[model samples]
Target: MRRGALRPFRSFLPGPRSMFYTTDGPHGLPHNPFMAVMVPRPIGWISSVDAAGNRNLAPFSVFNGMPCDPPVVFFGPSGQHKEGGPKDSLRNIEETGEFVCNIATWETREAMNASSALVARDVDEFELSGLTPLPSTLVKPARVAESPVHFECVHLQTVHLPSKLAGVSALVIGQVVGIHIDEGILTDGIVDMKKFRPIARLGSSDYTVVDTIFSMIRPG
Candidate 1:
């Protein structure tokens, strides 16, 4: 049955439409579904390495670039996995103080998703995901060769949010030391978003493509 077709019969008693946009706590039917419906969040294909030289890669929707003089980007890693403690990827970054954020495209979607597993700290996601790694000129961590854009970053800060949806969540901020854009993607010295065709996180088992785009100009 179509989801929309069956919607009118079922009613939401305590939802955004009824609560005037203010709801407390993180339980009940009013939590996850609400955030997921906000839809089409950009994916951050984060890559990091641990002190023992183990590599980690994963995808996250809680990612955004901070527009500052030198450029900074941020991604939030769940404090713990569904099974246990913090994911090794974020922990590795915390230990090494460096990471690489790769932009995921339709071409690398499968590989990006493959790395999102609950693996041990010694395991290498690059090997498990079957993606080629290119040596980074500026950072010790390697960049995914298939990705068109890569941001080599040094860890800046982490905000621990203990009472989030999960018992563990950390907002990691990084300063961009180097940026690499594939030559094929460069046009008139600008990186085209349309050409990127980046995949975005929607919800559980749902994703969106970058096909329809619009622009706006801020008033002076």
Candidate 2:
């Protein structure tokens, strides 16, 4: 296939009439299709420690690398937790101003899901998820031992998104001060996706693995 080619899948069943609704109102569907359409989002397996030395780990699907220079990344935590407050990972980063973004992979999918459980602030998610905590060189928050890649970041700022609801969503931006990559995943000094097999978040409870890959050179 050519680069950026569109491939439409035709269905024999009658499709629903196209409808539009403002985000402020209900989507008018059984389930919101917004997230569903934005598929294969990279999972930010964030780990952080609070001021009181409590460790927290959680996965945020709204995460991505901001830019290459200075190495920046961000993760958005939407809505309120069951405890009626920001998530532990967000709260800890707010307090300590440090975090580790561990890459999630197919091998650690179960542990990654386990870490997302809503637990008390004092609970150690590393232990709960049965994942080893690897000490970070520059950050207080430990990296997931099972993860092939880790980015030690310093909190830059948190941008709060406008919300009509009582609770607010925030984008936590961080400058990656250090990076760790497992040599095993590198082929000829380049990171190999086939070996890494990183997992991504889909809509609802679904997830996807990087099983297939293709490359294209940018047009001059």
Candidate 3:
């Protein structure tokens, strides 16, 4: 099958009204269809330095980058930590005021997923994923040395959102202070995404990659 192609979908909704449904009540599916319905979501492989200056890494599917002038990125942890309170990434970023958003690619997808495992607060995810942590230029948080691109950012603010479960669900907005890109992925000064092959989250237990390319110019 071609890259980004979708399989035939069979819906649980009945009759012609199937197209319309409300999320306020259960749709009678095996799993909650919220995340999957959103299609491919950007993955932010975030790294931060703890109080001990130890590195922590985690993958957030609910992450995105804004095309603002100065550039900005946001990510959030959906649940409480295994040890309690916020996740290490949030705690460390709030305390240290710095973090690095590593671009997740097909090459490091396995390692990125491995880092998402819920473990103790003191656990080092870089070691858990068997990836090297490189020092960032402007941030105390380490960068994934193997990643093709990275955005070093500082905490701007965090807005708490309603959560259906225990603990806080917050959206953390960060200001991008620095960026690092591997020149090898560039083609004649243009950043070739086909070579980058960044990965994204697609439904539960599934992921997709930017392995294909197409173009569409805006109508003038």
Candidate 4:
């Protein structure tokens, strides 16, 4: 087989006619396909601390890295909290201006999902998730000890987007101030991501593991 070539499956079924719908109205599917269509999104396992040092942890699928020169990252919080305020991760970052992005992996997948539960403002999700919190080098928010990689970031700014609900959605951006990488995931001083096996998010109670990897150099 040629590299980067697609192989046909015996049981493959051809999809029907493409269905299109406007955002103004429903698509008529039982569940929204927007998130599903955006497959294998990086899971932002964010950790932050409040003014009073109340730590918070949460997972958001709407997250990704942006602009490598400055090393920036962003995550989206779609709705208001259950108690009618910003979610703990957003609220804490707003208060402290610091957060840590812990890489979620198959090893800690269950604990990552557990931390996403709606909890009180005073709740410590690290404790709730049964994950050990290690003091960060440049931030007050603790890092997930088991995670192979961590990005300690300082909140740059937050942009509020219009939401259908009473409150607005938040797009939180951060500048990476510090980074940690486990040497075990490195090969010849380069990141061997297959060994890292970061877990990614999908729609409707689904998740994917990034164990398979390939690389291509850009044309000069």
* Candidate 4: tens digits of C-alpha lDDT, residues 1-220: 9997989677644567768789879899977799888988999899998899988899989999986887999999877778887777888888889999999999999999999998777789999999999999999999999999999999999999877766559899999999999999999999887788999988889999987888889979
- Candidate 4 TM-score, true structure as reference: 0.90
Give the alpha carbon lDDT tens digit for every residue of 1-220 in model 3: 7887988798676887655548666667776688888879989999998878988999999999898978999997768888889888888888988899999999998899899998887789999999998888987888999999999999999889986779879999999999999998999999999899999988868899998889988979
Q: Give the TM-score of candidate 3.
A: 0.90
TM-scores of the models, in the order given: 0.82, 0.90, 0.90, 0.90
User: Clashing residue pairs in candidate 2, if any?
Assistant: none
* Stronger candidate by TM-score (2 vs 4): 4
Model 4 clashing residue pairs (backbone): none
**lDDT comparing candidate 1 with the true structure:** 0.83
Q: What is every candidate's alpha-carbon RMSD to the true fold? A: 7.2, 3.8, 5.3, 3.6
Output the worst ten-in-a-row residue range by lDDT, candidate 3. Answer: 17-26
Q: Following a full C-alpha superposition, what root-mean-square deviation does model 2 have from the true structure?
A: 3.8
Better of 1 and 4 by TM-score: 4
Which ranges of candidate 1 are over 4 A from the true structure? 1-31, 81-84, 164-167
Error of 3 at 94 (Å): 1.0
Which digits, one per residue and each the tens of the lDDT, describe model 2 over residues 35-133?
988988999999999998778899989999977789999999877767788878778899999999999999999999999887877789999999999
> What's the lDDT for residue 69 in model 2?
86
> Compared with the true structure, what per-residue lDDT tens digits does model 1 show for residues 115-213?
887776666788999998888877778899999999999999988866536656889999999999987776788777777789998766788878887
Please report how far candidate 2 places residue 39 from its true position, in Å: 1.8
| Model 2 lowest lDDT segment of ten | 11-20
